[model samples]
Each structure stands twice: as C-alpha cells, then as structure tokens.
Target: MQIQDLPYSDPGVPDARSGPHLLWWLWRNQLGGQLRSLAWGLLHFVSVSALPFCVGLAIQAVVEESGTDLALTGALMLLCGIGIAVGDTFLHRAAVTNWITAAARVQQLLARKAAHLGSALTRRVAAGEVVAVSTGDVEKIGWFVEALSRFTAAAVTVVVACVGLLVYQPALGVVVAVGLPVVALAALPLLPRATRRADLQREKAGRATELASDTVAGLRVLRGIGGEDLFLDRYRRASQEVRHAAVRSARMWSLISAIQVLLPGLLLIAVVWHGIHLARHGRITVGELVTVYSAVMILSYPLRHFEEIAMAYSFSRPSAKRAARVLSLERPTDAGGSREAGVPRGDLYDPATGLLAAEGLLTAVVCGDPDAAGRLAERLGGHPAEPGVSVLLGGVPLDDLPLDSARTAVLVQDKDPVLLSGTLRELLDVPASGAVSAEDALAAAQCEDVLEALVQGSLEAADPMDARITERGRSLSGGQRQRLALARSLVTDPGVLVLDEPTSAVDSHTEARIADGLRRLRTGRTTVVFTSSPLLLDRADRVALVHEGEVLAVGVHRELVATDPRYRAVVTRETEEDPAPAGADRNLTGQGALLGASDKLAEIEESA
Candidate 1:
C-alpha cells in the first residue's frame, strides 16, 4: 500500500485471539507491502554484494597492467553504485510505507473499537493502557512488521553471499559460513532476560501514567482537601519506580547489543586471519583473498538484522496481546429483536425509577444525591445500570434498538460534557437532525460571552467561529466549557435530549436566560434536565423528585417545595450553617467526574 493510502478503507476485523496471532494477522493482511519492500531490499543487497567481486577484478587488472580490464571493472563498479542508490531509496520508501500503513490500521481499529464500546470500554480498560496502546504499542507493532521483510532480505543476502563464496573457494567459504551463524545466533540466549526487563519498564510507566491522569483529574478536589503534598509524594515515588525500571531495561538491551558487536568482530578476525594465511601459502590468489575478506566485512551489516528482528518480535508480542485484549471486548447488548426504526419521537419511560418523561414536554428530575442523578442520566442514554433493566422510548426499550439508533433518539448530555479542540464551526458540525442551527443553539445555551472570550484569546481568528479552542476546552473556564458543550448538544438536536445539570456552572442571571431560551427553542420537543437548581426546576413543565433511587413525588416545583421537605433540602441545598431562601442563587451541583470517570476510580484500579 502507498503512504497516502496509509489507513485502509476498512481496517477489517482483527483476529482478536492471542497477541502473536494478531501480529500474524497483520502480516498476512499487509503481504503486498511486504513483497514490495522485499523486492527492493533484494535488489539493493544483491547489487551491493557484487562490489567485493568487482574490487577483486580491478586489483588483478592493475597488478597485471591490463588497462582494458581495469576500465571494464570500473564501469561495472559504477553500475553497482547506481543500483545501490536506486534500490536503497525505493527499499526505504516501501519499508516505511509498510510501517506507517500498519500503524494507521492499528490506530483505526482501536478508534473503531472505542466508538463501539463507548463508555463501557473505558470502564473495562485502563485509560493509561488505552493511551499506551494507541501511541507506544502501535509503533512497536509497526516496527516488527517492517523489520520482518528487511530481515528476510538480509537473510537471503547472507545465504547468497555464502553460496557464491563456496562456489568460488570452498575452503574459505566453509570457515566463514560456520562462523556467521554463530555470530547471528549469539544474542538469542540473552533476549528473554531483556524482554522481561522491558516488560517491567512498561508496567512501571503505565502505573505512573495512570497515577498522573488520576491526580490531574482530581487536582481540584486534592487541593480542596489539602492533600496535594500526599499526592505529590505518591507521584514522585511512582516516577522513581519508572526511572529505575527503565534503567534496568536499558542495561539488559546494552548487554545484548554488546554481544552483537563482540561476536561479529570475532568472526571478522577469524575470516581475515584464515584468508591471509591462504594467500601467503598460494592456496588462494592475493586478489581472491581481498574479495573473500571484503565479502565477510559486507556480511556484518546484514547480520545485525538478525539480532534486531529478534528484539522487535520480543517487544511487539506483548503489545499485540494488549491490543487484541482490547479489541476482543464486546459490549453487552440485548439485541431485543429489532425495534421500530420509524419511531423517531417518543417519551422516555423508566420503570425502575417510575420516571415518566412524557413526550413534547420539558421534564425535570431532581435527585437528592448528585451521583444518583448522574447514574440516572447515563441509564436514560442506554448505559447499563443493572443488567436486564432498561429505559423505554415509545414502548420500546432503548436497548432494543440498535446502539446507534438508540444513541440518536435519546442524546444524554452527561453532567461533564467534553468540548473538543477545534473551531466553533467544527464543534457544532455534528451528526444532527438538522432541525436546529448553531446560532439558535448558541443563543439558547447563552454562549455569547464564550464566543467573545474565544475571539479575544485567538490572534489568528478572523471571526468568533474561526477561533480555536484548546484541548478539552482547558482555555475556557468551567462555566464556558459547560455552556459550549450544551450548545453543541443543541446543534445535534436529538429527539429526546436528556441533560444532566446542563446549566450548573453559570450564574443565576445566565441560568434564567438559558431556561427561557431552552423553553422557547425546544417548544415542541421532549427535554429532560436533571438538576437541583431552582431556576431550572421552576421553568420545567413538570418535576419528578427522586429519593433514594426512586421517584418519591411528581409535581410542579412550587408544590414540591411546599409539601416535600426532602425535595426542598436537595433543591435548595439548605444547611444548618448556611440556610438560604427559596429564590436565592446557586448553580446546579454538577458532580461530574471526568465524564463519570472520576466517580469510579476504584473500579478503574480494580479493572486495571
């Protein structure tokens, strides 16, 4: 495959069995690229191998004072040089194509698996592992694929050179052939130890990576609880462990490298000594001795491939295994006999919570615990809470529909939505229903200030829409990020939008305007907002009060505050130290844990 065709149109289904098998599968799939690389490598090695013989001919010609023979030998040498240049260039091109195409295929496969498994994939796999697999493991796998073909060509060159030596002079060929294999095979004995050390280093690095992500994710909470020093010390220790493990791995590899050099040097010494002795005794000509010695020197370059291919396989085997493990993960789907595809619009009904979000109405869910509200929001979007319990849309379980279909019908804007780095236009360009425009969504979400801030921060931006947001919207404040994410959801304009604490980060004035805009924009569509902020709840068409995972009361926000003390306590966030009036200002208590990632740190640790 060409470099431009790096990512295959389809990466195809992976073997997903064992790691070695996965690597083999990749090899079989990219055989064409391998063949091309091998062909070029053969041309390069064979042409280069002819140089020693040409040099021997020139030496004989000069010694005999045959100018004609010397000139012909010089011409042959020039042709060999040209062959070397062309063959090496194309060989490198083909080999790199193989490597890059292989890496791209693996990355595409991982991305596809992530899309299919969604949040469940994160729950089952470590974030650090995913990050590692996509970056480091991918390079290792590709290197192995590229190395295999080059190694094959090198092996062929060695065998061909040895055969030529035997045909020309059997005595020297026998001595050289015997020593060559010994040199190439010398590094095998130490590889297992080296591989073990490398594996230990990877484990340490992954631990440090996971620790770093967790610390950064909860840095706000860590500082709030005055635990920065504790985490700092913990990370420092993890960093040290990684450093020590890397040093050990390097030492083992260095020893292996030393063996590669030592064995080759010993063989070269033996070949030169034997060749000089033969020339002295008149058993071989001086020119023949020169050819034999030069051939042995040339063989050293290819011999390194043997040691390198071995090391590549050792490192990549484990990486392939990890990739296979992730690809094999299948999210549990009910496949509840195909639901109606035509039923795009429907009310979402959860039997477990007795929460009936009627069609074409703005329903609000108020939960006493922020965690419970987050879980309920996930459940509504077909996330598994308890197996076999599902929320239904228009009498059909959300799980019954295809995963993509369910996702389209009921879009759940979790408490902490992500704002990907891009221009505002690209962020809003989603797989939407096309009913809502970006402008309308931005207005509804009260993101005018966000647009102005983005424009001010970006120097290259010609318009607010042209401004670039940083990764995960780190350049924006919490409120700005939240508003931008909400506007993105609005652009998609899903059938039944379930928002968990959508307006929790904004002030009461912005919240009121957002509430008004939301009600106006989504006049005839179903919307569910899970929040404790009274500003949002009061504007809801109806409110369902959830207590201890069940809907305890269903009424207007005013009536619930008048009759139910539990609803009042949760919604008002009332406390003995700081009790507030009903209309007092407070943002929605958004307890989003890095898209529900922070809430299950223990779960992530256990799974890892």
Candidate 2:
C-alpha cells in the first residue's frame, strides 16, 4: 500500500498474539511489498519438502526387487537432488525478500506514528526508547514475520513425513510422531521467564541510551561548570547496570538454547533406538531404517526454527508496546476542517484563566517564573494549555475552532525557538506562503551582518535568500539563531503575536531597533510580549507585573519601575550602589559597556 493510503490515525489498541493474526495483519497491509514475498516463500517451502520424500521413495524402489530398476532409481534420485538444490536457492532468495519488506513496513509505521505525535512523542517516551524501537525492535519484528511461513511449511512437512513413515512401518512412525512434539514443546514453559528478562534488558538499555544522549547534548555546559567527571561517573554506573541486566537476559536465553539442543538430540536418539528394535523384530529392513534416521536428522533443523520464532516474539512484544504508546499521543487539533480568509478580529480571551488581551493593543505579561509565562503564551495561541486555561479568539473558544484556524490567527514565539538548517532566506520561509520578504524581515530584525554573511557564503547564488542551512543552525551564533527565529515569527504576520523574550539575545542597540520595528510592523495587530528586558518592556503600550501568578500592577514600564521595587529589579538588575533607571529613561546606548561593569567587578574579586 502507498504511504498516503496508510491510516495515520491510531489503530485503537494492538493485540498481543503470537500466531497467524499478526502474520495476516502484516500480509494485508502489504506495506513494502510483503504479499509478493510471502507468495514466493510458500513456493520455496513446498519445493524444499519434496527433497526428503523423494530420497525415501528412491530407497524404497531400490529395496523392492530387481537390478533392472536400479539405474532408473539412481537417475530419479539425481533429479530429486537437483530439484532440492534449485528449491534451496529460491527459498533463500524469497526468505530474504520477506525479511526486508517486513522490516520496511514496520519502519514506515514508526515514522508515520512519530509524525502524528509530533513533539509529544519525545516528551512521552524517552529518546533512547525511540532509538531502540527503530533499530532493534524493527529487526526482531521482521524476523518473526519472515519465520512464520517457513515455520508453517516445516510443520506440515514433519506431519506428512510421519504419516509416510507410518504407512511404511507403523512401529518406527509411532516413535517419530510422539518424539518430535516433545522436542518442540520443551521450550514453552521457560518462555515467560525468558520474556521477563529480555524486557528488563530492553528497559535498562533505553535508560542508558537516554542518559548518553542527554549527557552529550549538555557536554559543553557540564565542562563549563566542572561537572563533566560527575556526569561521567553517573554514566559509568548506568552502564554497569545495563551490563548486569543483559547478563541476566543472556543467562535465561542460554538455558533456552540448551533445551532446544538437548531435547532434539534426545528425540533423535529415541528414534534411532526404536528403529533398530523394529529391525531386530523383522518389521523393517536396513534400508528403511537408514531412511527413517535421515528424516529424523532433518527434522532437527526445522525444530530449531520453532525455538527461534519464540525468542523473536519475546523480544518484539515490548517494542511493539512502546511503539503503540508513542502512537497514542494526541495530535495537534486542526480537526474542524475550515480555513479563514484575512485574519481573526478583536481581543483573544483565555476563558480558563479569565485573561484577556484586548483588540489592537500591546499587552505585556510579567511573571517572575519563566515557566508560568510560557504556559500563558501557549494558552493564548491555542497550544496545549493547562487544564484550567482555555484560550478564545474573537469571543470564540480557541479549542472550539479548528486547529489550523486558531494557529493561523495567533502565533507564539518562545524564547529558545528551534532554527532549522537552511540558507538564511530558506529558514525564514515558514508556513510556506512567502508572506514576509527576506529584505524586510532582516531589516526588522537588525541582522544586516547575518544577511551579508549568507550572501558572501554563496547561499544567495541560486536564490539570494535560499542558502543551505545545517541542522539546528549550529553554524550561526546563539544570538543570530535567536534573531532569525524572531524574524521568522514576525514574517508569519498573524493577527496575534505573542513573543517570550524576543530580544533577550541581541545587543541593546539591536534590541531597541527590533522593539521599534516590532511596534511599526504590528501596527494594527494585537501583540503581547512576555519579557523583563527594559528595552522591550519600555516599548510596550502597557506592562503587567505578575506576582504570585496574579497581575499585581499594570501600567507603562516607567510607572511600574518607579513604584514597584520588584518590577525595577526584574527589568534593570538594580542593586544598592545604583538603582536601575525607570523604563525607557534607562541608558541603553552603551550596550557592551553595561555588561563590562559586571565583568570588571568579578575580576577584581578574583584578584582579592
């Protein structure tokens, strides 16, 4: 099936079955051409089963009477051997095709699930769990899928061989039939314990993976604070724990492997002893006894596949459960299926908190805790607001409207927004509508150097704005990335733009330019800036100093700083020697000079 045709929605819940149900589910999807491979596999298996029976028939024919028939029997045996060789070739080819196709389908499902869950997929499941499922889990699932048809044909061949033996000589057939089952069922009792151990191993591995990924991501910060050794010690301990878990899993599997070997060997011994006793009793000839022994020896190979299939399922079950959990995360809404022309009107209301940002106004939310401000911003833009926060746009509940409509009307620009890799121009081409021009956005962001660098690097050759950017825009400085993210948000031109620390990274001069540019760019739209920066706060039409999750004071930046000491400290980093200046009156011209004072003070203290 085409990827587009595959259901992106959740499949409700998965069934925990070990047999044909899962095999059929895989067959029906035909994702990655599984059905075609499945057909070829059946043909391969059928031809394989013909080899043993043909050999037995040749033996029976040669034993039956004349030297005249010997040549014909030898010719027939040669043809059968050639057929088996050809069948084995086709079987290996078809089996590999089945294996790859099954792996590919599971991979596609995993990718689709990741897309559906979006951000929540990582939040709900550890990064390591995702990695494990994609790599190890996919292979185990594929192994089980390909093993099923071979297992089926092997099982049928065994049964038919036993029946043929019964017709040839009932005494040998009885022993063969009963002994094979004992070998197959011996591993069943240990499955539960083996599965539990495997599950523990997988869990430990995921935890270790998560720790390793997180440590790498924060390696720079850890080194800066001299905490690298501490984290390394912790990781070493985690690695030992994973090692211990794996040892336990290996011990259990080793025991299962022993059973697989021991039981099959005992069954072969039992069949040989019974065939000899029957020969002594004059019920079977020497040639018939040799044929019986050969058939029992061949049975051991297929019997091992049974044990392997069990092991594969034990490993894959937890992985499937993890994949299912990831798929279960709720998707972002766009559910209603309607598009709006122009933009939304009036103030956006968050009913849950009874907060309102009036129409065509500059609203500022000041929360001492940065997280609270972030939650408020998400609520304002119809994001996953907390239980009590319900955002409304134009007197309509934001949640009630279709997801696309709410998102288009309100845009939330977080402090540390992600910058995708691409040319400076391509990075800003968000929402893919070309609503904001490259020159205009760069001017508004005061990023003249960034644009110039992009051009000089030949990024602008194909399309002045279309340079190739690396993943996460790691090539750019932190401040540049931040500004580029802000510029991209500004270009979207939403009716309501909520920015959390939009100017935190840029210099005072650039911050001031951006603040003024923002006021001009969003002249008629309802804009809310969440920050404590004096430059951004001073530019706001009004500022609300939020204390203890409530609005304590609301006014211009100057009014709040003059009257409220807490607001003054928050915006200007005031101290006893020199109180912070009030609002826009604060001197921001010497952008680098302000930070230099703090640096000098630290240096003097170090000398002392």
Candidate 3:
C-alpha cells in the first residue's frame, strides 16, 4: 500500500465486471497514493495561482507609495516560490510511484490468471492479444490512473480562482470566469470522435500484432511450403492498415490540440480587450487592469490539464476493457477442482476410449487416426477434449484433482512438443521428482547428438548445457527438437508419462535406440506411448490396437502382428525388415540417369 511496501503480496481479485469498474476499483485500492498525489498537486497549483495575486499587490503598493506593503508582498512571493518548488517535486514523485505500482498490480493479476488457467488460457485467448494487454495496455491503464489526481487538483484550483475573482472584481471577473469554463469544456464534442479513432487504431494494431505473432510462430512450416512470402505479404498489408488508422487517429488528436491552443488564445484576447475598455471608462484603475490580465494568463495554464485528462481517458478506456476481458475468462476445468489430490500411482483409465494404462507397465496404443491419438493424449493429462468427461486415476476423476497434483501424476508430451527459448540447462530444469538427472535423461533420450548440434551451432558456447536454444527451437531440426523434448519429459520422472508420436520424426536406427532407452529408463513406471512405429511397438510391455474409436486388440507386438490384421496394418508401413542395395534410392533426376546411364550411354550417344 505504501511506496516502499510495493508489489502487493496479493494484488487482490480485480473487479472485472467492466472496464470502467476495473478503473474505479484500482482508484479506490490505490487511494493512499492518489490522495498523496492530490495533496501535493493542490499545493503546487495554489502556489502557482498565488504568483499573479502577489504581483498585482506589488503594483498596487507601488502606486500608493506604500513601502511596507510592497516589502510584505515581495516576501509572500518568495514563500510561494518555495511552496511551488517543494510541492512540484513531491507531486512528481508520488505520481510516478502510483504509476509504477498500478502497472505492477495489473501485471501481477494477469500473471496469476495465466497460472491459474495453465495452457487453457491460450486455448481461450490469442497469444498476441494477451501480449498486447500485458505490455501496451498496462501502461495506458496506469497513465489514466495517475492522471486522475492531477486533473482533479487542477480543476479544484481553477474553480477557487474563479470564485475569488468574482468577489474581488465583478465586470472583468464575470467576463473571464464564464469564458474560462467554456474554453475548458470546448473540446467535449470532439472527444467522442477522437475516442473512436483511437479505438480503431488500437484494434487494428492488435490484429496486426496477432498476425505477426502467428507468422513468426509458424515461420518454419511456412518456409517448408515456400509460403513465407505469402504470409509476409499478408502481414505487410495488416501493418499498412494499422499505419493508416494511426494516422487518422493522430489527425483527430492534432485537431483537439489545436482547439485547446486556439480557444485559450482567443479567450486571452477578449479578456485583454474588455479590461482595457473598463480601464479607459474609469470603471477600474491601471493596477486593477494589470492584475486582471495577470490572473487570466495564470489561469490558462490549468485549462490544458483538462484536455490532457480527456486524452488519457480516451486512450486507456479500451485498454482497461481488454485487460478486464482477458481476466474474466475462466477455464473449463476450474470449477470441478479440489485441494485433495488423487493417488499418483494407479491404473489410468479413459472411460471414453475404454482403454486402460495399468501401473508399472509400458503400454503402446496404436491408434490408426492421429486426431484420435491427439485427443487421447490431452485426456490423459486431465485436459479432456469434450466437456463433462475426464480421465480417471485410482477411481478419482483427473479433473477433480488439484492442478499441480494432476500435473505431477500424469505428464503428457504433445506429439510436436515445443522447446522454449532458453539455455539447454534451463530447457531441462523442470519441477521434477529427482529420480532422473538431466544428464541421465539426455542419455536415455539419445540426445548426445542433439547436444553436440546445439554446441556446434553457437560460437560462444563453451559447454553444451550453456548453449541457447532459439525460440521454439527453430534452429534445431525436427528430430533433434523431439529428442530434446523427450529428454525434458524424461527428467520429470512422473508416475505416468504419455507420449504421442515421440519418435515420428527420427529414423529407424535412432527410433530403435530411443525405444530401448525409454523402456530401460521407465522400467517400473506407467508409460503410455501412442505410436505406430514397429520399433517402439516391439519393445512395449503390451500393445493395444485401436480401430475406428474402439480398442480392437491387446497383446504382445509379435502375437498381434501375426494374429490381428488391423494392428499389423497400422504398424506395417513403419516395418523396415529388408534393406535396400547401395545406390537403390539415388535420385535419377537427369535424362541419362533415368535411362540407366551405364547400360544406355552408348545407345544414347549413337542416336544423338
């Protein structure tokens, strides 16, 4: 709550009912800081507003030949100067503290939501949208929060000055006071237009950000099909649209800025002209005329705060709405959860699929459909594809267990697992059971070559463990990435590990080695590998063949291969029994090679 006691232990649940409500909640929560800022800001403005009065008194004292009054007026001016400096300095400090704390609070709330939702956050929201909210939108919300107090201080001082003027001098005060309010509220009509334009720009910018994020995430696949240029073109057009919207928004804001300047200048002219008329008509003295002129000039400064406050609100309202919307999202698995964890070691059962992965066994599920396999993998990890249905462990629904509990109980590595950007050591530095060391897991995953590849790719890497992996491991090949992901999963040493197509990208030689190492490393643990690779199938403790959504067969690989045609059909394409002779697969890309060069070279030469 205080400046030094920053980064609240708990940033309290946000009032995400709406954007305006969230802003109000933040204001009320940060009341202490806001009040401090307002007090200092009020002092600063009051001192500034006092300067013209002291100047007018000095003029009047000089006109009346009063030396004592003049001296006292000069002393008061010095005191006001001191007040101005001290108040201004502390006002800025408080505002900045409030700004930073407000931003930090929002960040903490967002991070908590992300952790609570886990991977489901991305399933519900776009990665780019979340990025925008956490980065750009946070600053906007904080700006509006800090600006509120300053604007209030400025408004209060202006009103006090107007009342003082009305009592001291009627004719000139009536003209100046009425005109100032009109000038302050002059930009109201244009605000809705400016807000609309700004919202359009932000919306387009968010879309452009989403496009760029998606393009970068899939840059590998895009390059594979030679479609990177096409995506690049799309992103370029989206960026252009954002640029145009920004220009339009800027144009509207510029018009508002012009009005703020132009209207005040016009007010100054009218006040000066009317005051000279009053002085010439013998209604006011020269000193009074000078005082009125000085007051009008001093008061115009605070009017700008009104325009600034409007601009800040216009920009941040949408940002708060976005933050509120993201925070409002709830995970489908959030309600049926509990603190009491289920048994970690048990026979995992998916009632939907009628397949069971018993404890202390390596089970292979040969599902002909990859989509079905992917769904099964998600279910095994408590992320059921369908609503109201969950995989069970030890007669307890996986969804009913606490998030961390379910995670420790079952680890499901997606078929195409991603390696986040970090050092090689960090990639494997997971919350683990400590049963398997990183080095041992790497060996078990046959990642020696992958480690060497990382070391070779970096010029400054003295150790493979220190080598940095690029974002999503784009710098590594598909097989190397799979091996690294496998090693990371192995290091966790969970009670049950589900791997979907763990070695689909690797060759038979590597696949065989990985399968042996996998079985050796997971000797007594529950491991379910969804694979159709014959090399992996032959080593499993049991194989279940799933055809059309039903478990059709369950037996040893050799028995199933000999007795069940469905199981054999699924794994047959991957069976590499006979070896090809040398040069058998060499490309016959040229004319002579296609005609069997050694046998047809002489005949082709004679024909030519």
lDDT of each: 0.84, 0.70, 0.86
Rank by lDDT (best first): 3, 1, 2
lDDT of 1 by residue, 351-423 (tens): 8889999899999999878888887888888886447478889888887787788888888887888778889
Question: How many pairs of residues collide in each model?
Answer: 0, 4, 0
How big is the RMSD of model 1? Answer: 8.3
Model 3 ranges off by over 4 Å = 1-7, 341-343, 368-372, 544-608
lDDT of 2 by residue, 226-299 (tens): 99999899889999999999899999889989998988788788878888888898888777787777777777
Best by lDDT: 3
Candidate 3 local lDDT, residue 97: 88
Q: Between prediction 1 and prediction 3, which has the larger lDDT? A: 3
TM-score of candidate 3 relative to the true fold: 0.87
Write down the RMSD of all candidates, one decimal each: 8.3, 6.6, 8.3
What would you estimate as the lDDT of candidate 2? 0.70
Best-to-worst order by TM-score is 3, 1, 2
How many steric clashes does model 3 contain?
Answer: 0
- Candidate 2 wrongly placed segments (more than 4 Å): 2-28, 31-39, 65-118, 331-345, 359-361, 451-469, 547-554, 562-608
Q: Which consecutive 10 residues in model 1 have the weakest lDDT in total?
A: 586-595
Say which candidate scores most in TM-score.
3
